[model samples]
Structure formats: structure tokens, C-alpha cells
Target: MTWLVTGGAGYIGSHVVRAFEDVGLDVVVIDDLSSGHREFVPGAVPFVHGDLLDTGLVEGTIREHGVTGVVHVAGFKYAGVSVSRPLHTYEQNVTATVSLLRAMAANDVDKLVFSSSAAVYGTPRTDLVTEDSPVAPESPYGESKLVGEWLLRDMQRAAGLQYTALRYFNVVGSGTPELCDTSPHNLFPLVISALVEGRTPTINGDDYDTPDGTCVRDYVHVSDLAVSHVAAARRLAAGEPLAPVYNLGSGTGLSVREIMDAMVRGTGIDFQPEVRARRPGDPDRIVASGGLAAQDLDWAMRHTVDQMVRSAWEARRASRD
Candidate 1:
């Protein structure tokens, strides 16, 4: 049984592709290379450079590869950018998903593992959010993801498609030296870039009601999240019922200041960060329970914040070198 991984050349997608291969699964990639790197796709897997919105190309790829399942990871992910470009976000995240599902149904490829986000649960009133948490997305990126999940649910009910939507917190760390995250919107890389250039990493929102008055977030290793994709895919293939949603994370929270301190510790670099006003749509604190994932999917994150920072710093350093 072969799999078609959308956005398979991107940061987390490439890592999931590698994880799939590690477990002996046949893999093929379809990426537009807009935010992904061509060099990230391993030579063993065949890649199709195209958009998921192109139904004909997507359908053809599924049929050509004999793809029995898909891991949908292609979408706009920048929170602030999505706000300014909501139309583009909707086009890439929601509209593309609808088209991709239709193409999958047409091709008889029904199984899927979706890459969702914690942004779906806006500013959580409670620190630890479960799968049952209220679905209130604050940003265009979050709303688009929620809409994607809704699309899958409706499609599954009507078209017999089975899917698992893994709502990720902040996905940090690199897959390998070759697969480092290059997103300017991502906080870790942005901080790393600042340190590399001898500039202070800026910290926004110093008065959030958290322990340290900075925004707290759950950070999960990209590799661990990728492993969950592999596990979920295999379980779906083995006839497990479609458990539509699960939160993926370390089940702990780290503040922005703490993360910066860890980065400084990891790199032995020091510069007092500039304080800035809270950005719009920025939440005070967000952490995942991930109990459902642990119970149903047997997933648990093994990487610590220190590990996450060290690995991320290592990847960023190697990329700069």
C-alpha cells in the first residue's frame, strides 16, 4: 500500500515522509515547492511538483502511484501572515482541501492523516486543552484548519473516507540537517536568525497572565509528531475506525521568555531581548492534554524543551554553516 503525502517536501511533511519510509511504507510526494524544498524529498520517493488545488494532477498522482492513503500537510501556516492574506489562506488551506478530498474520493484513496493546529482552540480559558475543547479559532490560519477538519468529517460521512486530524501545538526541532524549517513566521527560527546576526530576539506580550507574564505554548518535537503520523496511518490501514481528531504535543507549557533563555543556554549567546507589544491574535497561553492521542493512538512525546531547543539550534547552526 502506497501513500501520497501532500506537502511532502516541507519541513514537517518531509520528516513524516522519512518516518513513513523508516517503517517500510511505500511513499510518493506531491508538493508545489512554494514553502518546501526540492532537496528535502528523498531520492527513493517519487515527487510530483504541483498544487493540491489542481484536481486533475492530484487525481492522476493517486491513480499513478496506487496510493491507498494520504497524509495531508499542505496549507498556509503563518498566523500573522494569514491575517493579512486571509483569501490566500482560505484558497490554500480550505479550498485546496475540498478539491483534494474530491480528487481522493474519485481515485478511491480514502485514508488520511491531516496536519491540524492548536490555533483551532483560540485563547484557551483553561491551560490544558483536550480534544473536546471549544473550537474557537482566532486567526485565519486557525479558522482555515478548522474548516479543513469539517470538510474531512463531512466527506468521511458521505464518501467513506477515514481520517485522523492531528492538531499540533508549536512543532519545533528539525528532521535532519537537510530538513530545517525555513519559515520566517515560526518563532524558533526567527529567534535563531536574530542570534546568528547578533541581534536580540524580540519578546512580545510581557503582561499575559502566565507565570512569567509571557505567552506559554506547548512545543512538540517535529520528529515525534512525524512518528504520530506514521502510527496513525498504520492504524487506519489496519482497519481501525476513523478517530477524526487528536491533539499532538508534549502535554506541557513553556513561556516565550523560558524558550529564549533555553535558546541562549543552548547556543551560549546572550543579548537582552527587546520587549514589544502583544501582536494581534497572539494567545496568552496554550497547552494540549493529548490524552486522547495517548489512549487511542498510543502516542507520547519524548523530547523535552531543552532537547527541542538544542536540536533546533543544531539544525539552524548547520544550515548557516
Candidate 2:
């Protein structure tokens, strides 16, 4: 049975596609190329160019590819941007998800692994976010992801749709140099691009209540996150009972200054990052406990912070124009 990966050409989705390839699983990809690069998809894999909002296109791809399961990864993913473009955010993340679910039901495709976000928890009150943490999304983007999860929950009860949602924390690093994170809003890219262009890196704030006075976050490598996606898909395909949701994160925290130090070692740049005012809505610290994912989805911290910095640096350098 072929597994269809929506948005399989984007940074994270592309890595998920490679994980499926490494396991010798037959897979098909459907991406609109909005923020994804078509070249990221391998030529051997069947690629469908279209949007998930088009139910007909999605249903046709499922039928043409004989898809039995899906990994839903496409969405309008910028949290801050969603604050201003609420309508656009909901349309892309919520409505598009509804369209996808409808297509899945029409085609009798029941098994799915959804790509949720830690933003569903917003700024957690606790030190470590767990699967049971209260969901309080602060942005339209986060709200959209939460709605997608609810849709999955409703469908499961209504139509017995077999599914699991993985709420990912900060996803960084790269599995290959060819597949690099290119989003302008991400930290790794911002620093790497500055270093590449011979500009000094800047930190947003340094007066947080954390140990280093900078925002602390759980950073997991993209490759590690991708493996868990594969594991979740395998469990669903095998009809093994799995949790409805899992947190894909490192059960630890890293301050921005600590990451800067890592960048120095990883990129060999001997410059201090300029301090700036904190961006509004920036949380003090938000790390998650990956114990649940580790126990069930083959999740592990396969890369260190320095390794994350180095991999991102190298990939950025390689993909420079």
C-alpha cells in the first residue's frame, strides 16, 4: 500500500519523504510548491503538483497512487504571521485540513499521521510540556493546528479513522545538505544567512527569567522528527494501537546564548551577537518532555546543539545563491 505525503517538498516534509525511502516504503507526494521546492523531491517518487484545498485533486492522487495512509504536513506554518493574516491562516491550516480529511473519507483512506505543532500549547505554564498539557494556542497558526487535531479526533469517532497527531517543538538541523531549512522566519536560517553574508548575528532578547536570560526552547533535529513520522505510520499500517497524540521534542532546554556559543563552534565565527529588544509574544522558556514519543515512535536526540548548528550552517552554505 502506498503512503501519500502531503506537502512532501517542504523542508520538514521532504525529510519525512526520505525517511520513507530509507525504509523501502512505496510513497507518493502531493505539494503545491507554495513554500516547498520541487527539486527537493526525488525523481523516482511520484509527485503530484496541487493544493490540498482542491478535494478532487487530492482524492484523484489517492486513487491514482493506491494510497492506504497519509502523512499530513502542509499548512501555513508561521505563528507570528498568523497574528495578522488570521483569515489566510485559517483557510490554509483549518480549511485545507478539512478538505484533506473529506478527500480521505471519500477515497476510503483511513490511516494517517498528522503534523501538529507545539504552538497548540502556546506558552506552557509548566517547565516541561507533556502530551496532557492544556492547549492554549495564542496565534491563528496555532489555533489552526489545534483545529486540525480536533478534526482528526472527530473523524476517528465518526468514521473510525485511524490516526495519530505529533505535536513538534522547534525543528532544526538537516539530514542532508541538499535539503536545508529555507524559511526566513526561523532562527537557524537567520543566523546562518548572516554568517554567510558576513554580517553579525543578533539575538532578540537577553532579559528573560531563564538561566542565560534568553528564551529557552526545545530544539530537535529534523531527521529525528522524520523517523518518528515513519514509526507512527508503521504502527497505523500494522493496526497497532497508538496514542492519539505524542510530543516530538527534547526533554531539555537550550538558551539562545547557549545556541550562539554552539554557532561559534559550529560555524567558526568569532563574533558576538548583538542584543536587541525582545520580540512581542516571545515566551521565556518552552521545552517539552519527549518520553512518550521516545517510548513509542523511535524518537531520540541523535544530534547535539553543535551538530545542529554545524549541519544547518553547512547546508545553508551549500544552498547559497
Candidate 3:
């Protein structure tokens, strides 16, 4: 079955595309290049440069490519910035999803894999979040994703849309040197860029109630995450049963201090990270239990902290060249 991967030029999407290729699946990519680099897309894959909000364009692409399934990975992903740009966030994440669903229904494409986020849980009271945890999204970005999932659910009831939403937490590392996290707000890129530029990386909060007095979070390698996407897509194509939502998380989490120490060891930058005041609404810990995803999507923490740092550092440095 042919599949269309939205945002397939971005870090995680590009890796998902590669994973599809590795499995010998025919895939097409659609990316607006807003935050994704064109170079990240493989030379051999068919690419359509356009926005998803254009329903006609989305429908034409699906029909032209004979797409039977879709991996919806495109969205406005910055949680902190979404507070100021709520409209833009909704337009990209929610409205765009509506448009895509419309086009999918029009063209009879019923299978989908959505790239959701852990932010949907907001600040969970418990340290280990399960799939059944209450969804109280605080940011517009998170709300948009939750809304997207709701749309899919409603569509499933209305049109028999087979789907799964993968809720990601702190996605890091690289499957290949050609693709790397470039988000200005992501911890890995921010910290790695600071070190590469000879600036000290700052830890947002060092007084959090954790073993290292820093915020603890789940950080999964991007390649491992990509594998799960392919698995979800395969399951969808084969009509295998799947949960509506799955959390791709490390059952246990690591602290920011531990990440910084790994960066120091990996990059040979033997400098301490600066401690800064805690950002408002920052939770001390937000790790999820991947038990559900582990059983269904073959999810596991395959990369160590040092390996995540090393792979990300290598890819970031390569991109600068």
C-alpha cells in the first residue's frame, strides 16, 4: 500500500520516511518547508511542496499517488510559543488536520497514523503517566493535537477511519546524520547549539524535586520512534487492531543534569551547565509508562543518554557544514 507522510522533510517525519523505505514500502512526502529542510527528504522519494490546509491540493496528491494510508506528522509543535500565537497554532495543527481528514474521506483513504504529543497530559499529578491519564492540555499546541485526535475518532465513527495517534515525549537522537532535531525550543538542539557556539548551556530549573534537583522527562531516540510509526502504519494496512492512542515513552526518565553530563562526555565539552530559574508551570517530572506502546508498537529505549547526545551532536555539526 502506498502511503503519504506529511512533514516528511522534518526531523522525525524524515526518519519515518526512511523507516518506510527500509521496510520496502512505497511512500510519498508532502512538506511546506516551514520548519523542515528540503535536503532532509531522500532524493528518490516523490515530494509535493504545499500546505495541508489546501484541501484540493491534498486530495489531488492523495489521488495522484494512489495513497491508501497517511502518516500525519505535520503541525505547529512549539508549546511555549503557542500561547502567544494561538490562532496560528490552531490553523496549523487543528484546522489543517480537519482539511486533511476531509481530503482523506473524499479520496477513500481510511488509514492514518497521527503524531500526537505528551503535552496533552499537561501536568499530571502522578510521575508515571498511563494512556488512561486525564488529558488536560495547558497549551494551545497540546489542545490542537488533542482536538486532532478527537477529529479522527469522530471520523472513525462516521467513515470507518482506521487510525492511531502516537503521543511522543521528548523525542531525541537521530536515525541518520542527514536528519536531526532543529527545533529552537527543543532541549537537545538548544543545549547542543550553545555548546557548539562556545556558549554555556543553561538548565531551566535546577531546584526541581528530583534526584538531581532538575526536571526529569522521557527522552526516546528518534530512530526507535520512527520504527514504531512504521509498525503502526503496517498494522493499519493489515487491518490489525490498535489502540486509538499510544504513548511512545521511556518507562523510566532521565534528569536534565544527567543529559548535560552526557553531553559533556559525548562532545568532550567539559563545562558545567548554568542553572536558571524555573519556568512557570514547569513540572518537576513528566515520564510516561510505555507499557501499552511497548506491547503494540515494539517501543523500547534502545539508545543511552550518551548515545542520544553523541548522535544528535554529530548530526547537528554535520548540518552546519
Roughly what TM-score does model 1 have, to 2 decimal places? 0.97
- What is every candidate's alpha-carbon RMSD to the true fold? 1.3, 0.9, 0.6
TM-score of each: 0.97, 0.99, 0.99
Output the lDDT of residue 98, model 1.
Answer: 89
Query: Which candidate, 2 or 3, has the higher TM-score?
Result: 3
lDDT of 3 by residue, 1-321 (tens): 899999999989999999999999999999999999899989999999999999999999999999999999999999999999999999999999999999999999999999999999999989999999999999999999999999999999999999999997899999778888999999999998899889999998888899989999999999999999999999999999999999998989999999999999989989988898899999999999999999999888889998999999999988888
Model 1 steric clash pairs = none
For candidate 1, write residues 2-106 as lDDT tens digits: 988999999999999999999999999999999999989999799999999999999999899899999999988897788899999999999999889989989
Number of the top-ranking candidate, with TM-score as the measure: 3
Tell me model 2's lDDT, rounded to 2 decimals: 0.93
Candidate 1: count the clashes. Answer: 0
- lDDT values, one for every candidate: 0.88, 0.93, 0.94
Off by over 4 Å in 1: none
Each prediction's total of clashing residue pairs, residues at least 3 apart in sequence or on different chains, is 0, 0, 0
The runs of at least 3 residues in candidate 2 whose Cα sits more than 4 Å from the true structure, single-residue gaps closed, are none
Which TM-score value belongs to model 2? 0.99
